[model samples]
Target chain A: MEYLLHIAILVSIYAMLGLSLDLIVGYAGLLSITHAAFYGIGAYGTALLMINQGFGFFTAMLLGMVISGVVALVIGAVLSRFRGDYYALGSFGFNVIIFSILLNWQSLTRGPLGIPGIHRPELFGISFSDNVMFLILCIILGAIVYGVCWYLTRSSFGRVLTAIREDENMVQVFGYATPYFKLVVFVIAAMLAALAGALLASYITFIDPSSFSLNESIFILAIIILGGLASHEGALAGAFFLIVLPEALRFLGFPSDVAAQMRQVTYGAILVLFMLYRPQGFLGKFRMN
Target chain B: MDILVQILLNAVIAGAIYTLIALGFTLMYSTAKFFDLGYGALIAVGGYATYWSYKQIDLPVWLAIGIGVATAGLLAFLVERFIYRKLRERKASGTILLIASLGVLTIIQAVIAIIFSSQFQTLSKNIGSTRTFNIAGGVITDVQALIFISGLVIMTGVGIVLSRTLFGKAVRAVADDSTVASIVGINSPRILGIVAAVGGAIGGLSGIAVGFDTGIEPLMGMSLLLKGVIAAIIGGIGSIYGAVLGAFLLALIENLGAWQFAGEWKDAIAFAVLIAFLLFRPKGILSK
Candidate 1:
């Protein structure tokens, strides 16, 4: 049961990641690989504050989100000038550059040794020690995240994002200021990613560069794609499906090494196949309208 | 002066590998107008293939290299014919295509890890035992010289093929406009497959060089591909000889940066150059 709770917490984290990505990718039509970079920044930000400055949970999270948001703001400012593949490349370059910093900045990031002993969340004189308690806390956060997604996608701002996705030049011609809208969506999405990262680090009590590699970024993108692009339900569904589906594969009697490879292959194959066969995704609308 | 000469020589060899990979990128970008992130994985395929062919089967080392390049090219061709072709047939968006390449990269890397266990391997068993020559106060290892010569010869050959051959004319025509080329019955799909195969082979050679030049790992492709893309971009993406020049310049800059600072700053220097280019001259140095 505790094992299941652990998986649930992870699923909740991924749900947040997927939802965050859907805003930028699905709604805003930006394909960025830097979401993981923001996530890493958030994780490391919280770790540093707590470990170095002795910050509590709420304060650290707020600071971490701000840090990630600021970084995203700068990155989004320069990169939003590009569209489509250029944006992806720019974001990818940014991700790698951030990754390089995290790897080589031994003095600050501790390099590959990683930070350990991060404590769980403490609120109102109560600490989240039990797996069930943590899961509840995470689920609440996830729900709040979903509500935000719901509200944003339902607003005129979200309509701007959708129009930008379909045709940025057209939106600009209408004096919609597409870049500003894109920057806003990007930073908001980045904060959500960081929020998930902070929760994940607190829950696991450890943080490493490995957790925020390009592969992790792709996996989050895959969750959004697999669940259905631009659909709130798909984000949650993808989180649940990909997280639990692999565990089911564990029972299929495959060798451990092969099983690992299969998981990687499945993630790729599912995304590619689904995109080709059904670009709208499992639960996505045929049209954004 | 001796340190300068040696560093220059080392940079030249590094530039050779970068040029090879960047050529692959430049060709695809020019012809297809999309980035094939999977090219890096193809390079890994070539490196591993060369290792397996020579080390396991006891094939001649050079012949093994040929097989590795051909196999990688063939793999790229198949992917173009199958997945990429299908996607292109559907008139899929560029975003979708890019994501698909990432998928290919993921699956191929997994296959490699499953087979090789993520262990770092070197293609050259006698790299350390190779002969060295000192000329004019600069010492050049046999492998280093080999890399430099092979890079030049292959680059020249590519230049000839692009100018003299009818196939080259078709490739250039397709690059200009795929629709017009297809109207002329140029077999766009087949041409794309062949072009992608050639790119993959070049990419494979680049990987093999690095595997022998340094060491090989499944994840090395990520960084190597970045350097290659940077070179292509710096040289004005899609230019034939521009990528070569860009590679040398990037290598020289990185080596000089390392010499001035520490080795860890090499990547930062490379990316800093990229950012500078993106900010100042988004079109690149060789932007034609």
Candidate 2:
């Protein structure tokens, strides 16, 4: 039961990440691979505030979101100038830069030693120290993000994002500043990613640079691709499936050494197979070109 | 003055390795028009093949090198034939290809790790046995000199192949416009296959050289690939000579920058240079 609950908590956190990324990659048609950087920013932000400043989880989370947003604003502005593959490359560079800072900024980040003993959230006299309580908090936050994403995608602004994704020039020709739209969605996605990061930090009670590397970003990307691009249900389903699939594989009884490597191989095979045959994904509204 | 010479020599050796990788990378990018992340895996494939043959099977060094290069080339050909070709036929976009390449890279790296136990392996029989030569004020080991010589030889060979041969003409025609080239009966797919094979061979050779220099690790491919990509992009993507130039320039900058700071800063400096180039001159130094 406890193990199941732990998986549930992780699924909720990843669901948030998948949903946030869906906004940028699915709706806005921008492939920003630096989503993990924002997630890390939030995780580190919340961890640092709680440990150093003695702040509550809610406050630290909010602050983390703001910090991620500010950084996204700067990066998004520069990145919005690029289109298609260049956009992916630019974001890829940003992720590397952020990761390097996280690893190298030893004075502040404590480097590879990682920030340990991160405190659990205490909100409105309710301590979320228990696993069950933390799981509830994560679900609530995930739902909130999902709701925001659902509403945003259905709005007129959401139409413009899809328009930009399909044809940026057409959107610009119709009098919308496409870059501004891209920047707005990018910032929103960063904040939501940060929220998920905050939850992860609190739950794990530890954070490290390894968790936010380029591979992590690619793993999150795999989640969205496997789930379905541009579909909210797809994001949820993808997160649940990817998270649960690995756990299910664990029960297959392969040697421990080979199992982990096999899991990665499976993931790679699935990604390649999907991209080749089912570019539209299981529940996706749009097909990745 | 001695330190300066040492740094310069180190920079040149680094530049040679980068040139080989970047040349292959640029060749593929020009033809395929996508970032082939799978190329990273081929680097590891080359090194591991050499190690398996030389260490495990006890093959001669030359035979091991030939087997390693052949393995990489054949794997690249198979990938292009089976995976990338099918995708290209479907008119898959660059982004899709990139993602597919990432998947291929992941699969290959994982397979390598599973087989090799993720432990760093050395190809050199004895590091201390290598003879060191003093060129001007800088010292270079035999392996480093071999790498430098190979880099120059491969660059000249590729340059001649691309410029003076009918095959090169076909490759250039395909790169300029695959559709038009195919319409004119150049057989673009065939040219692309040959390019992938050639690129993979060079990439494999680079992997072996790097293994001899430091060691081979499953995860080292990504960093090496990134440096090569950076060189290709900075020198101008799709331009062979430009990539070679960029490789040397990048090597010089990274080495000089590392001289002033901690060694860990080397990668950061390389990336910073890449970002700067991307921001200021996206076309790179020599625009094709």
Output the lDDT of residue A266, model 1: 83
The prediction achieving the highest TM-score against the true structure is 1
Second chain of candidate 2: TM-score?
Answer: 0.99
Query: Which regions in candidate 1 have their CA more than 4 angstroms from the true location?
Result: A254-258, A286-289, B135-138
- Candidate 1 lDDT, A241-283, residue by residue in tens: 8889887767998788778777888888886787578877889
**Against the correct fold, how does model 1 do in TM-score?**
0.96
TM-score of each: 0.96, 0.95
lDDT of 1 at A170: 92
Q: List the residue pairs that clash in candidate 1.
A: none
True-contact fraction in model 2 equals 0.55
RMSD of 1: 1.9
The residue pairs that clash in candidate 2, if any, are none
Chain A TM-score across all models, in listed order: 0.95, 0.97
Model 1 per-residue lDDT tens digits across residues B1-288: 999998898788889989998988888778878878888789899898898898889999999999989988999998888898899888887777888888888888888888887788988878668899897788877877888888898899889999999999999999999999999999888889889999999988888888887877876788788899989988898898889999999999999998998787777788778777877888888788
Provide i-RMS per model in Å.
Answer: 2.6, 1.7
How many Å off is the CA of A256 in candidate 1?
A: 4.5
lDDT of 2 by residue, A1-289 (tens): 9999999999999999999999999998887778899999999999999999999889999999999999999888889988988788778767777887898889899998999999999978999999999999998898899999999999999999999989989888899998899999999999999999999999999999978976677778888898899999999998999888987667988778678777778778877988899987789888766
Q: Residue B265, candidate 2: how far off, in angstroms?
A: 2.4
